[model samples]
Target: MVEPRPDQKKGLKERCPELLEIARLVSWCMNRDYLIRSCLDHINRRLGMRARCVLKEKEQLKLHCWLGEYECRMEQMPICKESIVWKVVEEGIPVNLTETHQCEGYSHTLGEKVKIKAIVPLWYADQVTQEEKRVGALIVDSGKMGMPVSDEDFEYLKVVGELIGAAIGKAELTEQFIDSYKRKEIMVRETAHAFRNRIAAIGGFSRRIAELARDKDLANEAKMIYHEVQLLESHLEQFEKYL
Candidate 1:
């Protein structure tokens, strides 16, 4: 890789520290244990405004992570799922707002505090099957402690939101994997004694049958079963790696 000139490096750090910080934070999200609140704090500091993460909890939007001046008392907001910002999340797109009047589903009271903004949905694939799924949305509101949000803030928020979404997806995957492992641990412990012996015996014979079975279909079925077990083992290895 070519090294940047001293002048170029200094210029980048001075003029684009916010973008650099965003990149660093996203890289941190590769490890699922990274807290969403901490991330919001980082973004808030970068943008010099409030940032929050709203998750699609059942039929309502719930504030999962938040940072900044105003107290977001509406923890469980019952806005329509199809509302402007929520629709962007549900559709896995970014919603940029240049003015408060253009917002949908937000309480009128919040209009004074919220300014130009961008809401980006963090979409991810099901870790096991890689199915498209919408997990959460990141909310970035512009303006200083007192100033109203502006178009420039909206543009910055929109760009930042896109990069942040990728990190959110990675974090969500880690979270889901951790949850799955915990659940699997409980189930495995409950039945380990009973299943271990049976699996060992079957595995031994299945290996032999897999090599000698005359029926191609039966051999393939045995192979598939072994592959499933291998997948489980791989997950266990990942749990250990993380632990």
Candidate 2:
């Protein structure tokens, strides 16, 4: 059996410390851009392989972050919105090379030689619903030809994938929570303005009735108007409570 390269041994040594940093960065990243870059950096440094983070955006997954000695082949192509990676992201599963090349769309998008060593899902813990899809995959690549990845490597990738998943999920939830809060604030403001307008109209009517009360001929009419105005004012008070 061929011995693992010296660099590969060093790469294995680096993974533990690098994983700690990856955890910190992923947990804090607020968006696809941050998450992608942070993960790519972690994988490349720790695994000593070309690594990339593909983030799922609307209708497509994009190669947003890459690190390695060679340029990313995936980046060379225009992103296919209809690819399987997008499907996996939509379905919230991590599909490796075994699965990747099996699909026609993915084979065309990610070249054949680029034996995807692993496809690990980055779960976002903040995601309240399982229906909420995965953010992306942490993909590791080895340049060597037909070199089968070891079982241990695949297991390590899975662990890293889970870490990445948690970070992605947290980022997604944080954004969603912020968006929901903003929408509520806007609703409150609109309701307050509507209430204010209603109150102002009632006040105007009350003032008119008061002015009419000064006329001796219209005194009875004005008294009835004043009573109606009070009723409207009371209704406005009730509306305010709801607002």
Candidate 3:
């Protein structure tokens, strides 16, 4: 792992409190949006810079959450193929760049003068494929000219990216589980309803046949059919209730 710069290491003692808070916040957050928002808020508060979390949505890099003074026109917009964010996503590595103009797409959208300190890619394993994927990037900018990004800040952002990735992966799995459960529930409900309707129809017809039967044997058989239908109806009711 890359180590923090010597000057950044000197201030690590003073950053412990914020680090602890971030740890607590990340651990407690299960929702993707909440986790990203809280993480960005914490980083912005501690660093006094604009922080944004952008997630990949289909082909676009949509802004998931953000904090501070930077205007995010790229929110919900497609990430340009030539942009730095795209580069980080493609490389699956953290990048520190002082000049925004070097990234053509980023400069075109946000402007050439926009000051960006670093962009860190957030990665998570796909639930279905189990393959590692770059889900998004955390972009941090000082919003001022020539502010060098510190190694400690980069290290902290990397940790935040990992936490966000884990949270997003867990949340996606949870959603899939919930959706599967709902589908099963709907199937059960529909099956139960259809079974109940069929049983009710059989019971009704048998009861009517029993009433109209002239022969005692025929009446008794019809009554027995109704009784069996009633039992099946009771079982279906129980099954529906269990579901």
Candidate 4:
């Protein structure tokens, strides 16, 4: 294999510390919403640029969370496929724009006054198939002056995207597990309730038999059965409370 460039190696080494920090932050987040918000905040603070996480909902891209100077009028809005942000997400590639004025879609989305520099697509790998799936797009803008985004910054954004994707995947799995556990608990509870009803019926019949028995031995056995059933019913009642 061909050796990597010196700058590429340097970039990788430089990202190591930040990646560790990102990993820690990702682990700290327990839910999907928190993970998205935390990732956006981290990216915005680290890069000192305005960042927004836009998720694809239906056919439109909706702003899920953002951090920075730009004030979004509409939280949810339709995005044209021709738009740079949507193009990045749909293509699973990052786009760097040197001149914000040149891109019609960018200007239309943010207006003529605001400046946008770069947009990166956030991808999550499917748990079972390990296929890269587009979750959203991370839009980066520098406002009025139109600051230049370095190549290293693009690399860093990609790393952040991967970290966010992994966290989201983990959160989704946790949700699935919790839901599965609840379903099992409900099944067990229903089964126990059914069993308790059967046992109660049997105990009622046994009590009646004990009352009607002419032989002392038969009456004693019937009474013992009824007593054991009551004990079982008491245990089941306590178990149901836990479920």
* Model 2: CA > 4 A from native: 1-17, 71-106, 110-112, 130-132, 144-148, 215-243
Candidate 1 lands at a TM-score of 0.54
lDDT of model number 3: 0.75
List residue ranges in candidate 3 displaced over 4 A.
Answer: 1-20, 71-76, 98-108
Full-model lDDT, candidate 4: 0.75
Worst 10 residues of 2 by lDDT: 70-79
Residue 127 in candidate 3 has what lDDT? 75
Q: For candidate 4, list the clashing residue pairs, or say none.
A: none
Each prediction's Cα RMSD? 12.2, 6.2, 4.6, 6.0
Global lDDT scores for all candidate models = 0.62, 0.62, 0.75, 0.75
Clashes within 3 Å, all models in order: 0, 4, 0, 0
Instruction: Name the lDDT value of residue 142 in candidate 3.
Output: 73
Question: RMSD (Cα, Å) of candidate 1?
Answer: 12.2
lDDT of 1 by residue, 1-243 (tens): 112234322222353666667677777657532556666766565556677777766767766666776654645454444456567777787766665677645543243446466777766666678787776677776433433434455555555555555666777677878999999877766565456556666667777777888999999988877776666656555655544
List model 4 lDDT by residue over 95-164, tens digit each.
7777756576442465434444777887788787888778788777666657756677777777887888
Q: State model 1's lDDT.
A: 0.62
The parts of candidate 1 lying over 4 Å away from their true place are 1-17, 28-34, 71-83, 104-115, 127-130, 143-156, 179-192, 195-243
Summarize candidate 2's per-residue lDDT along 1-243 as a digit string, tens digits.
Answer: 123456555343455776677677765667756666666665566556666677666655666666765533546243455555555666666665643356554543554445445656555644355554566666676655334455556666776777766766666677888999989878986876787677567667756766756776576665566677677667767765764
Worst 10 residues of 1 by lDDT: 1-10
